[model samples]
Target: MSPIQDIQTEIDAHNDIFKNVDGNRSKMVKSLGSTDEASFLQQRLDDMNQRWGELKAKSANIRAHLEANAERWNRLLALLEELGRWLCLKDEELNKQMPIAGDLASLLQQQVHCAALQKELNEREQLVSSTLDQARLFLADQPIEGPEEPRRNLQPKTELTAEERAQRVAKAIRKQAAEVSEHWERLRANVVSWQEQLERVLDKLRELEGAMDRLELRLSEAQDVQTTWQPVGDLLIDSLQDHIDKTIALKEEIVPLKNEVRAMNELSGQLVPLDMQLSSITTRHLDDLNMRWKLLE
Candidate 1:
């Protein structure tokens, strides 16, 4: 029979048992009125009633446990649903707009954004972990299976199905937790890729900035040597040699500057479009440097 029907039948049986016993108790009291045995019989009946009440209370405790289990099932479903929606939304958003930065300022900002995104993912991961633990705890604490139960433990088949139901729910929750964790890993990979790309761009920009700054200083010093060429307190047979050595040293320094510029451009490899201003400035300075070098020659 169905659980509800079985429960109703049990209720009816209990009510009939109590009703007949109560009627018999009333008849006995009436029959033994004002007798010494009447008080002793009343005490015995009171003891029996207390024992029966204890039995009823045990049944009530079982029913209360069942109700609590049902509430836990609902809680697990709700948490899984909430976690699923957040995972899906974040996955879609991350895929749609990858991190891209055109300049160092924006690149630094993108790094911050990525860090914050990862922090959010970490929080979600913890929630998923706790939810999975809760599911496992529910499974551990859920009622035992009917088939494994002894004959004395028998109940309505439908009510005994609670064990199977709990197992299925836990299984489903486990599957969802796995999927959510996978989604989190995917999002984390994208963030890592984004951070790597940012590092590449930032490294290139800083390298170029350093190289260009050095080039500017060396070029200015060389220009001053060429434009303001006055021998410092010297009139000797080897005076011409000093000028030639000075020019040669300046030429050597400028060669590395050119090499630095070339290496940077090659590394950048047209993949990242740097600012036009930096390129234009480098080109202009190199042209002036070439003209200055020729005058020294």
Candidate 2:
């Protein structure tokens, strides 16, 4: 059964028990005629009335506990509904962003690869530049190597005709020119390729950076929502907790009262016979007073 129903059922049961106990006491009181018997019945009636009072108090307490629990339950249910709505909104927003997030991630991965390739190209370019610098330095130091032969130690040697020397020098110069032109063309091609790769890397890096910024903005927005809700959530929880605390306090108050009633019940049970004797003794004492007064007259 439901909680409320269960509580009501228990209350009904307690009420029935109290009614039966009271009814039985009433019947017993009607049957008694002797003063001592009447006195005992009166004491029983008083104990039964006290028990009724305790039952009434218990019923009130149970009702208060139920009402407070119901209130807290309602608050919890509302909080849960609010949370559900908030989560639904968040989920919808996240769903809307999913495709964009996927695209950005793919682009970022591609950019990473492109950046790596560009880095490699830059390294190659640096190597090529260093090689050219070494070549230039080698050429600059060429004349410094080897010593010139002394003219005094040289034998008279036959000199070639100027036209012949010019022809031979022209042929050698042409060959060197062809080699230098080929080397410079290859270097230019390498430089162009490196520049293209570097540009691609820089472009990809920029795209990745933009994607990162967007991601950070989205995260910030999510954090803002969380921060906003946290306090509201805490307040709701605190309010519910306060309700629970009040319910507990009510129970705490009721327990001592219940214990006092129980103690009174035990005392009543102990004193019943003594009260009956006092009633019987008083009845006989009055009879003796009546007889002595008649004799005295």
Candidate 3:
């Protein structure tokens, strides 16, 4: 059966015991009215004493159960709090790394843009080579031209042989190609460095995700334990309260009985030991109940 059902069964059993004890106490009080029946009175007193012992044992068991439950609850609470702190720390660490992840994303976008530009540059270089080839074919068809004099027109100009002009143009294109190559190399290196950084950041993020998953599992388990034990805790508290009330009522019941026994003892001079034993048992159980209350607190 369920835990709640088990607790209800225990309560019902205790209630039955309480009814029985109250019934026995009433019988003992009625027996006390016939003081002349010494044998019957002694038997009744012995039965009451036995009942008191049973009650004390039951109370002790209940108290022990309560104490153990309290300790377990306290430990569970501590575990839950510790898990909460760990989760908070993990969250803070993840937040701190978010900026780095964002920066890596930006770098990747720039790298993609740089790659597109590089592709365009390669296409332009191919077009330039094709133009140069066409120009060479056209020049070869014409006769070689000799060096010409400098022209003094709207713009000052230096005339040169075809070969010299071709050499200069080729040299400038080679220099431009070299500069583009160097820029591409530098850009490539930066991209590689950013890629390495991104990998490391991704690794850290994966580790954080794993840690968070484990913490979440632990947190969920703790929550389940808390949920499952809550009803048991409530039942224990109710039982404790009932015990306290019963103990108080029993003490009040015992007071009048003890007084009556004491009066009977003076008359019979034989009931002193039983009265003293009952007092000691009552006192011990009261002390135990008090200690249980302290533990509960």
In terms of lDDT, the best-performing candidate is: 1
Q: What is the C-alpha lDDT of each candidate?
A: 0.64, 0.45, 0.44
Instruction: List residue ranges in candidate 3 displaced over 4 A.
Output: 1-160, 231-233, 237-297
Model 1: ten consecutive residues of lowest lDDT: 143-152
Candidates ranked, most accurate by lDDT first = 1, 2, 3
Model 1's alpha-carbon lDDT is 0.64
Error of 2 at 90 (Å): 0.8
- Model 1, 201-220: lDDT tens digits are 67876666565566557667
Structural RMSD, model 1: 10.2
Cα lDDT tens digits, model 3, 228-291, are 4334345675587765665465445434333333342342222222221223443353344334
The ten-residue window of minimal lDDT in model 2 covers: 95-104
Residue 54's lDDT in candidate 2: 71
Estimate the TM-score for candidate 2.
0.29
Write one digit per residue (lDDT tens) for candidate 2, span 1-297.
323334445666777776776778756776786679878877977987897687667656755654454444344334334433433443343334222111324435534544454454455555444443533433342222233333343356856423223233333333343444355445445445544543444444344344434433433443454444434345675476765665465445444333333343343243333221123443353344334323322
C-alpha RMSD of each candidate structure in angstroms: 10.2, 66.1, 61.4
Our tally of clashes for model 1 stands at 0
